[model samples]
Target: MATFNVNDIRNDFPILSEKAYGKPLVYFDNAATSQKPKVVIDALVNYYMHDNANIHRGVHFLSQRASEAFDNVREKVRAFINASSEKEIIFVKGTTEAINLVAATYGRKNIGKGDEILISAMEHHSNIVPWQLLCEEKGAVLKVIPMNDKGELLLDKLNTLLTERTKLVSLVHVSNSLGTINPVKHIISLAHQKGIPVLIDGAQSTAHAPIDVQDLDADFFAFSGHKILGPTGVGCLYGKLPLLEEMPPYQGGGEMISSVTFEKTTYNEVPYKFEAGTPNIADVIALGTAIDYWNNLDRPGAVAWEEELLEYATSKISAIPGVRIIGTAEKKAGVLSFVIEGVNAMDAGMYLDTKGVAVRTGQHCTEPVMLRFGVPGTLRASFMFYNTKEEIDCLMENLGKAIQLLQPQTAL
Candidate 1:
């Protein structure tokens, strides 16, 4: 395995060199999305310039090349997650669409009136809303797995939650707002005991750690390419082959159909059936390059160095009188969410912007978590493998300045 070298990795992403707010950019909103590396960018250019053609239909040279390149990504995704087959992998717009596809298809078919769907309090809006829509349509109830002050899931309550009527459990593998890495393998095991399927929203977890779906025994796993240094508008959903084959197609159109007659239309096979219409061909092809970029890097080394950065930042931020950390879980990923006393998160974010530090200031699409924490929102600083401890120092220095400027009297 390759060792973690921050300087060399940073050089691979050209955006790291650009200036924002008149200073060198210190991007910390990685949970929102990651910056693309040069290789992925070049892949995009290469596809458009050379292999510009529609896939799966044309028999011409460029079309065959494009189709080959596009379909090859599916195999990479299958291998990346250790999924049993490429047919189990379905391409969607991103994590949101992937979740919705399952909810609309498998969920609508499996869940019925008075049935239950279980989720956690820390889920992003994507995980919450899809099931809510499905429940509203099917007369099902949504059950929540509660959490404690540390933002960890209350696993003790899970036994009662997973009843016979419970149809499915969709939860986040990592809390985007809190940076809490949930014990998903344990959660999956517990759910399996009830013979209930669990779909892990791996949008936050995929970029931070190694994911082996077979080892986790995940029923369904979803993640986005953009979060893993790939292009936006392209993501993957990994399902157990049996489950995917059982679920109905999410959409209809070309490529997803095996036969079309005046009387009836026959849907295509498992993964292709779920994927309808002309897909995001170029972005899907570039995602393979993104996966290669991630595969070459030393993931374990990055995780360790990232934990060091988080600890260092947490210690320094805690020392500041007004700063309060939100998620204090023993296990966390590459996110640090906090609030400053007497300062609006947006104002603080804007203040940091002047110093060229990019951080997200919002509920992070996890409003229930915000309500639980008794904060309107938080200033979130999410790190990645390329982020450095020196950047944390810079953030702290600027955060102190922002807080002082926000409260002139307190500084005096």
Candidate 2:
């Protein structure tokens, strides 16, 4: 296991050492997608080089090897999140598909006309749109839990929202744009009390903190691999065994079937039922390597260092003129979103890029959050454990220059 020294951890990610525009790269766009670790990259290469075969179907030696490697990742995901069984873990493209799977399957089964689905205000479009589609299809209503100016959900309003007609509560564990760490466990308990199942969108939270589905008592949880230092196009959805069994399959295809006649086909059991067609074979194995890298790190130390980075960056940036920090939650994770008074966010972002600082500037797929905060968009600088306070200094220096360059000259 490697100690959580930022420099040592930084070395494991090759991109961190690369030059961007002839300057050292300072990657603060982790919330959009994390940089891949070398071990994860190696795993992808090794699989393609030696074990390139379709999984779970072929009887050849390469197929057997690939199948074993693929199936082993399911178990790793089960243990990674402490899911009750490997049968509860289903592989999807990413969190968006995972939420859609539930909305299409369990929602269509249980939800009815006039029923309600509760969600928070600070949801990514991925979380919001699927529920809207389900509601529109079923004549159901979508209810939102409002957040305060600080981006904290008003939990006091939850009881009123979780009514008899409420079918499910889907919440984001962390705000991708706001950096707020939501109390999803408490929200889950509240939903469970009303016999409403809860699904947590854990895309941002999974990489920053430890997850135990059993401990959280979450009915379903979804997260992406790319957000956790793994390869893209693969992710996990953890559902309770009973709920998954009761729900219908999201799609119809090869692996999700048991037997097929010309007239009717028998579906496979639980997790397999949700996985349709050929899966992302190489990326899934590479995600397992990502889990291994996470498990072997000083996680607690890394978390503390990230906190320090956020704090230092926040204080430094807040002190500058024309800077208005958005998402001022008392409890935030690795995100720092703000808007300059006179400069457009996109212009600022591009200016930062020329200085070798990569940040995201847009709605961040959380248009509702932007609407709530009354901003068109924001410049979001999200951090990770491997990031350093020195890198933050570079962000502040470059941002100061961007503001001066883009800000309109006042009436002289």
Candidate 3:
């Protein structure tokens, strides 16, 4: 088997070489966001340099070119997740907006009072809050599936939770905080048997590895572009045709309309209907570049190298005294959440930062996860394909020093 080359692959990202605190930057916070590639960055610049114009309206050259680029990204995203058609893809601000869109449109339409919406304990706030709001507004009940100590969900509980009152089953594809890869295909199949639609929060999963909406047979799947190599303020929601067609428009404006006047206004078709207003023309166009970049790369090799980092880091970091690794699931990916016994997670985070290691600290938008583990928060070292084992060693070395400083002082 040909091994993935970490050094050569790192060169594609220019920001990786930058320094901080007089040390080379070791970004271990891929879950929050990933560094953009030259392709995506160049596309952003190229859009403004040439194809800068309002899309979908103007018949002029720049507008037509810009519109094609903007609309083409829908197809790119459609193919990216193996969605049935471009019509299934709706570009939103981020994962948060995508979730809210479904909750407002579909949940408001289908879910009703006394009905139940089931989620898991490991879900991020993006998944939880929207459902909570929908429940509150619709007078529905929000149910949670429990997880074991290893962060794996109790599938037995899920079967019980999928009751007659259950309107929808929404969960995370991968835990952002726990790094647990949920059995989404199995989960979806189980939900489908109950005739419950499933929505996957793919914000964390899409960037780390490959995903197929069809293979999972999910009713709706949401992901953030920023979590991958694409720009912030751009993300996608993939819903099955019937579900999207039935739901109301999320926001009403120019692009989303067919005809509008003082009287009743007609809306556009599926994807465009949910997508109102002018939209982020440039970033949406650039998103296709990010997709293209990921598609062009040796994806299997990239994923293999990421696993290598996870394995190497897990081995080294766990060996340290007072260092406890949370979420020891066998099927985890790209995240190493831990806490030093005596050290505050933020303290460890600040110390790690001084050493030029950028790792995320605290709840990571999954407060329920912290509560489940009975901790305040965790210091998370989330990896990416571009990260190196050498960086992992640096993190380990710095962590040892930080742990020592945080240790109780003894008589000298």
- List TM-score per model, in order: 0.98, 0.99, 0.98
The residue ranges of model 1 lying beyond 4 angstroms of the native Cα positions read: 408-412
* Model 3 stretches astray by more than 4 angstroms: 1-3, 410-412
Distance from true location, Cα of 24 in model 1, Å: 0.5
Full ranking by TM-score = 2, 1, 3
lDDT of 2 by residue, 1-412 (tens): 6667888888889999989999999999999999998999999999999999999989999999999999999999999999989999999999999999999999999999999999999999999999999999999999999999999999999989999999999999999999999999899999999999999999999988999999999999999999999998999999999999999999999999999999999999989999989999999999999999999999999899999999999999989998988899998999999999989999999999999999999999999899999999999999999899899999999999998999999999
Candidate 1: tens digits of C-alpha lDDT, residues 1-412? 5688899889999999989967999999999999999999999999999999999999999999999999999999998899999999999999999999999999989999999999999999999999999999999999999999999999999999999999899989989999999999998999999999999999999998889999999999999989999999999999999999998889989999999998999999989999899889999999999988878888788888888888888899999988989999989988899999999999999999888999999899999999999999999999998998888999999999998889647444
lDDT of 3 by residue, 71-190 (tens): 889989999999999899999999999999999999999999999999999999889999999999989999999999999999999868999999999999989998999999999999
Q: Which number leads on lDDT?
A: 2
User: Candidates sorted by lDDT, descending order?
Assistant: 2, 1, 3
